[model samples]
Target: MTHFKSQVFLILNELPSGECIGYGELAKQAGFPGYARQVGHLMKNLPKDSKLPWHRVVNSQRKISFAENTDAYWQQRHKLESEGWIIVGNKLTLNEFDQKEER
Candidate 1:
C-alpha cells in the first residue's frame, strides 16, 4: 500500500470498537490534516470483505457520510449500532460516544 493509505489504515485500525471519529479527524490522525475527502475515498474503496472497521468513521457533523436509504448507509449504521453506538437518523450521538482525535 502507498504511504498515505498505510497511514490511514493504521489510524482506522487503532479505533476502539464502538468508538467513532469524523473523516477529517481520521485524516488528521493519518498525517493529512486537510485530506478528509481523501479519507472518504479510501474508505469507499476498501474491499467489501475487508475486516477494517470503516463504519467507525463518520462526517465532521458526526453523521453517517453516506446518503440515506442506501445500502451502504444502513450497513454503516447497523455496524455502529450493533457495537453499542446510538445513531438517531444519520447523526451519531457524539456527546455520548465521541472518540475524537486523541493521538
Candidate 2:
C-alpha cells in the first residue's frame, strides 16, 4: 500500500466507536492536508464488506456526505445512529456528536 493509504488506514483502524473525523481532517491527520477529496474517493471504493468505519467519516460540514433519503444516506444514518449519533435534517444534531467538542 502507498504511504498515504497506510497512514489513512492506520488512523481509521484506530478510530474509536461513535467517534468521527471529517474527510479533510482525516487527510490532514494522515499527513496529506490537501487530499480530502482523494480520501473521500478512496473511501467510496472500499469493499462493501470492509470493516473500516467509513460511516464515521463525515463531510467538513459534519453531515453525512450522501444525499438525503437515498439508500446510501439511510444506510450511513442507521450505522451512525446505532453508534449514538443524533442526526436531524442532514446535520449531526447534537453537540455530543460534534467531533470538535471535548468529550
Give the C-alpha miss distance for residue 66 in model 1, angstroms: 0.9
lDDT tens digits, residue span 27-84, model 2: 9999999999989998998999999988888998889999996998999999988887
Off by over 4 Å in 1: 94-103
TM-score of 1: 0.88
- In model 2, where is the ten-residue run with the lowest total lDDT? 93-102
Candidate 2 achieves a global lDDT of 0.88
- Pairs that collide, model 1: none
Model 1, CA-based lDDT: 0.88
What is candidate 1's lDDT per residue for 1-103, written digit by digit as tens? Answer: 8888999999899899878888899889888899999999999999989999999999988899888979999999999888877878899874344555332
Score residue 54 of candidate 1 by CA lDDT. Answer: 96
